[model samples]
Target: MYSLHLINKNIGKFYENIPFSGLTSLRFMIVDENVQDRESLKNVLEFLGYSVVSVAGYTEASKHIRAGENYEFIITAIRSDSCMDFEKFLLSVKDFLEDSSVVIASERAEESCFQSFENDEKIAGAIHKPYKMEELERIIKSVRQ
Candidate 1:
């Protein structure tokens, strides 16, 4: 399949969700602890013609946000060990991402985890990890509507 054609020095990770072709004027920031997932997802999104920035954890994401970097979408996985307080972290960074849609990403079922942020319009929704690049595209499309 595409794995053969896409095998190059620049894209080292195995992309499991790329659907061959697409084009979009969207930007995304993906935060995940697993290097494989983060890079693969970033690669897939990039392949589909989206601007993607992948980071290992919240700490790295904070550096970009603190530096005044903004994106149309922010897909992140929150962990108690890495980010002690999800609410506090979101609150602290809310100003910088007011126009951005925050999508919580996790391998676990995390529908209930984002309840607190329901009042805040910034939260677009939640997308489970290992998600297909198409799923993320859907979320972004919905954000426009």
Candidate 2:
């Protein structure tokens, strides 16, 4: 026999009660110094269907943030040049309550840096350098949840 085309007649009823219900719009940014890394991350985030913005360094990232924009996630790597003051940038991010997630890519296993940021009570996670795409997806999903 042919497959039954059973439709959930009650599907539309699911939206009946909730006054505020919609697909969670996820917006995020990537702040990385290395051109390759920055671009690669941007491409991956976009591929994963996120509203992504990117900056090359901390200064640029700060400018974007100060422009009164909002983002649900922030993925950053250690600064490479003077374009962004890394310390100040980190502090600013820590100050934002809506900053749901952050993943810092470091060059080495300096768990101290990760620990320090995570201890801030806002920072959610950190991804060390040379991570796999799967890792990124996992972290992003965790943040969204």
Candidate 3:
């Protein structure tokens, strides 16, 4: 009993009526030592409608985790100047996060490194640096699923 125009209008209104929080409730935490790379990734993710919090190193990230800030996704670099043992930092915080996916991103990450954490349930995935937006989105979607 509705015309095509009426149906389209209703659909638009339905979507517009939805709250931002309802539409995007997925929270993300990004940890990287490179300022440019960290901000660029954060901007891209935010533009794509995901809530993101970026930190320069492990210490800041640990503070958030310790304070019980729950992030659905945690994207971190494999190496940092301040955090000598990046893998150890990730493993240490695994217990604090409840059902959160930890994705490692680094230019030097290789198949061997991924293989090492393949058995670790906390490690959701890995992405090499210089990745396209599509590649990053694909990884994020896969981890959320």
Candidate 4:
């Protein structure tokens, strides 16, 4: 079980035991071509006690990696309208993604897709589009364990 705390910046007061990952400070980056989806997911993650940074496309996301920013988890869209190759993108950032969980989110992901990245130690899980909040939370918790 994890517990979350909210700290008041202005007063420098700490609100303890807010009911999510109290001990862990999880940072996440979201790479999705869809603006709406990216923002929506970012909001959900922030609400769930994660520090999230979201980018509109692979190019922007790569810039973050090039800058040497590290994240505890990365959630990316499998297929982008810009025709970015998901696997290639993953490989390109493998160096900066050490020990971080990678989750692929797609509307058309199949079992074969999961198997394809199964051997990659960074891949933590896959979620179909329109996933429930509970489902996403479950995957995150499972990977953390």
Candidate 5:
């Protein structure tokens, strides 16, 4: 079993058995409209040894995707009220993202189009907000696998 050292609330610091070398080469992208949440999650991911890039919204992230900045995994917050549409963005970049894993993060996860996100083959996992260490580790492990 794995454990953690909780930070504030949006993310967790994982001390799992994942090798540091294994994580160094993996790239991650975080997309969230909230700056504080994005930065906080980025810090924890970095501390756990993964390289992370953060963008405020899907539109900005899509630009990077189009530019060919590939990522092994992407964690996005799909909100019901956000101005951006995560589904639309994902569909637009379907070809570039075919092999990449996507994990959706949200507090209001059950309310939006994300309600059926797990059914989408593009997604690797989903975690509710007030993040938990196990869920984070589980997703990372799947990505590594």
Candidate 6:
């Protein structure tokens, strides 16, 4: 089971300005290495009225997106341990939409991280590691806008 500490912190902090009110069509995917992180993100997104799916790493993340469906949001983590390039993982998601919203999470989210995808406008934004649920909500709302 995933830890609830981080997720509990985000309770009630849903994105208020969802581009589409009611957002019945907002589907999200949370891709991260840690089971706890994935579960936490899934819970938070679901609470905010989004239909969510989750995967543990890049491999599964790619599979889910490649299943011939479109998801409104993708929240992923940079996995230095997985031998996969974050850029490549993101590229795999490009077939979905040119304006897809992606929120990348990293343990050390330095400005250099932003530099990596600066050329690719599809990458909506990033989240630093050890994030609270509220922070995730804010990022999602900002990126969706």
* Model number with the top lDDT: 4
> Which regions of candidate 4 are displaced past 4 Å?
1-24, 81-83
- Count the clashes in each prediction: 0, 1, 0, 3, 0, 0
- Candidate 3, residue 119: CA error in Å? 1.3
Each candidate's lDDT (Cα)?
A: 0.72, 0.62, 0.71, 0.75, 0.74, 0.67
* Candidate 4, 1-145: lDDT as tens digits: 6555555443344545444645238888988887767776676567766799999777778879878898888888887646568887887888888768988888775779878997888988888764345556667789877
The runs of at least 3 residues in candidate 5 whose Cα sits more than 4 Å from the true structure, single-residue gaps closed, are: 1-6, 9-22, 80-83, 109-112
Residue-by-residue lDDT tens digits, candidate 1, 1-145: 2322344344343434445433466778988877777787787678767899998877778779889888889888766335545666677788889578888877887667767566778888777766555567577768887
| Displacement of the residue 135 alpha carbon in candidate 3, Å | 2.2
- Which residue window of length 10 is worst by lDDT in model 3? 1-10
Cα lDDT of model 3 by residue, 27-50, tens digit = 889889888678766765675577
Clashing pairs in 4: 3-20, 3-22, 4-20
For 29-145, candidate 2 gives per-residue lDDT tens digits of: 888777666666565455545678988777777777777678877777855457445566777655553665667777688787677677655565777764445456566667666
Q: Which model is ahead, 1 or 2, in terms of lDDT?
A: 1
Model 4 TM-score, all chains together: 0.79
TM-score of 2: 0.71
Clashing pairs in 1: none
- Candidate 5, residue 105: how far the Cα is off, in Å: 0.8
Of 1 and 4, which scores higher on TM-score?
A: 4
TM-score of 3: 0.77
lDDT digits (tens) for residues 64-145 of candidate 6: 7777656777778867327567877777668765445777787785779777876776776777766455566576667766
**Which of candidates 2 and 5 is the stronger one according to TM-score?**
5
